[model samples]
Target: MREQIETADRRRLLSRLAGDYHVQTARRAATFMSRDIVTDMTILAITRANVRQITASPEPVAYTYEGVAGVPADGLRIPVSVYALAKDLGLPYENIRRRVKKLLDAGVCITVDGGVVIPGATVVRQSNLDLIAETQIATEKFVAEAGRFGVTAAQHYRPPTADLPKQIIRLAMNYFLDATTFTAKGMKVDVVAVLVLRAINMANISHVTHDPALAVTYAGMEEILPHEARQPTSVYSVGRFLHLPYETARRAVIRLEERGLVQRGPKGLFVSPDVVTRPDVLEGMLYLVALTEAYLKDLARVGIAYRPNPGSPG
Candidate 1:
């Protein structure tokens, strides 16, 4: 029998996977929350903590549509303190406190005896038919992509209920926290700063890969560009997308430049090939593969109907 990976390694792998997953998930959630990035992120931080608490249970978490007492039945009511959110997300206490208040005032979250949680009503509002449809499409695509790396045995599994989108977001959020923790130690920078860098890289990729056919030329591998090739991204754009302050984003970009992770391009700032190919970066990619395999197993455990996606490359 194959030996199981140690718990620490598994956590690291999942965190890395979740971090990459956040690049898309956060954007989606931000859109749903009316483009309030701080509020959205604060809510996610609490939800992620809640999911982690439940997932550590001795048995597989069962689905529930009815509330027990006053707590949300579907989403595990894991109470999270504001200070904990600040510590976990590497943001300042005052910022998290303010966002938490906004969420509370907006009915997006409720305070329980111990702490705050996203209520069932809020979740219901968030998980509309459009969001569900979008999630189904994205989940199918994700399963198909994971198959290329030999992690597809449970690809066809679908969650038994309509709450899969929420679950996916929860899992992604949990991974995001795990990722932020690991990265802060490894790169000695805030997670928000890392996000700025990722935003710039994604912008550059979008600029170059004009169409699927052009992307096909690289066969899904990282496309290398000559140093002379200009892939410029403005700090304002990155800040706007991430909901960060312009000065904060600019400082982060400056720090990355000093570390040789990004360089000024014809347009603005772009990720350096050196940074992309770094040993630590490559290892993170490996962790993503491991996380995908483990995530599939978790889905199967929860009884999602596993099947090949129609978009699978076959």
Candidate 2:
């Protein structure tokens, strides 16, 4: 029989897996949205609202990805207002307005009566398709990784009838936002700071999941990874990876270090094991695990049954 992981061990494994997945997805979104992760997030929120509006039906609507992507600009019934955007994103009204204006100027988003909406044409573009495909792959990889640790859906496998890529994307975006918001609030830091910190963590352990030996060793003991196994990464590399400015990355790192969340050495920077095991940080990790579980459950409701690998060590 496979060893059943305790709740605490499950939390640690899921938190790390979720963090890595979201950071990579955000980085890809940033690249697709002209090197601005926030912009991509903003657009995602708007698109989600619009999709909800369009798909509001008393009966089940099996909307395919192509069908939804083909909806005309005028067909977008509900436009997400700037105020709503700001509130949802936990950003200032003026800041959101400015970003909306920039998007309008770039023709990436258009002004409707209530607010702004990304054009259907934009959604159907090659870049957006590539993003969707990449996100799907990432989602699958996350499921597979979780399976290796004996985390699987409670339901039987059932394939989705509709190609609801938009719904999947919306859920993924919500997960990202929830994770970021939870960490930022818990740590008393901003979204950028949360991203910076997560990026650093990802850099340090990016190789663990790929190596079977390392993955098995690190599964429930991530907080106690040996110093030699943890890779030290620089602010410059983190900045480049996240498409953040050098100063922004540097300042975030400094802030983290001041809070005893990170440490700098002769080679580079790394988050120490002690810091990872802090009560507050562990709380955040548990929260992430909860969010991830909810996400998987939602996927099942959407008709995508995720099963753990049967051959995986129990």
Candidate 3:
């Protein structure tokens, strides 16, 4: 018989699932924006603001995921200033201004009377559509994986009349920003450090999630897998994967190691079980769980059904 999914088990599963989804989606966004993950984050911040404006308007037009692409460039896009963006992202004003300038030069964003907006024309592009499609696929995969671990949507839920995909994307962006901000401030690390550590964590457990036996064996283990089960990853590999410069990745890893958040071994690098079990790190994991639960509930509200498995009490 399969084991029950306890709170700890669910937290682990959700963390892994959210980590993978964030990395994949961030990579795609970076590619689409022709910029680094940080810049991509800036763009997401702007887009999130615009999305909010559209959704909050009393206008009669419907805003489905596809329909959003057809909306007028200036219809409901509430321009967000650099100061506001900086505040929202917890980044410096100069940094946000520089990124916004680059985006303006690249035509990825346009300056409006008040501030800037990711234009509808940009959103209608094939590349943007492709990015949205990829996010949709990743979102589906996340839901499926969570279901495998017995985290399913409630049966009585119903889909909302509003734009479900757009709202979900906004929720995801919010989760990413909130999680990044929380981890950076709580752990006394930069965004790059957070990404590097997450990359290492994902690398360490990639195999366990791939193999059926290992997946089942570790599904309820709340702590990190045994050292023998981990697949260590090198700094160079992480740098290449995240499109970060070698020295930048190296420095971040070194800082993480010095902080006792990462471990170095003969093979490569991995997050230590001790680090995973730390009170602060565990709190961050629970924060991630809370955000994920809220996200799932939103999906459930929109009738994206996630049923519990046979004989499982969800």
Predicted candidate 1 versus true structure: per-residue lDDT over 8-59, tens digit per residue: 2332222222344546655665556646555666777776665566656423
* Each candidate: RMSD: 6.1, 3.9, 4.1
Query: What lDDT would candidate 2 get against the real structure?
Result: 0.74
Q: CA lDDT of 49 in candidate 3?
A: 83
Q: List the candidates ranked by TM-score, beginning with the highest.
A: 2, 3, 1
Stretches of model 3 off by over 4 angstroms after superposition: 1-8, 56-61, 64-73, 159-165, 210-212, 220-223, 308-314
Candidate 2 lDDT, tens digit per residue, 30-94? 88776876677778777767776555432234443446642435464478899998777777789
Rank by lDDT (best first): 2, 3, 1
TM-score of 2: 0.85
User: What overall lDDT, based on C-alpha atoms, would model 1 receive against the true structure?
Assistant: 0.58
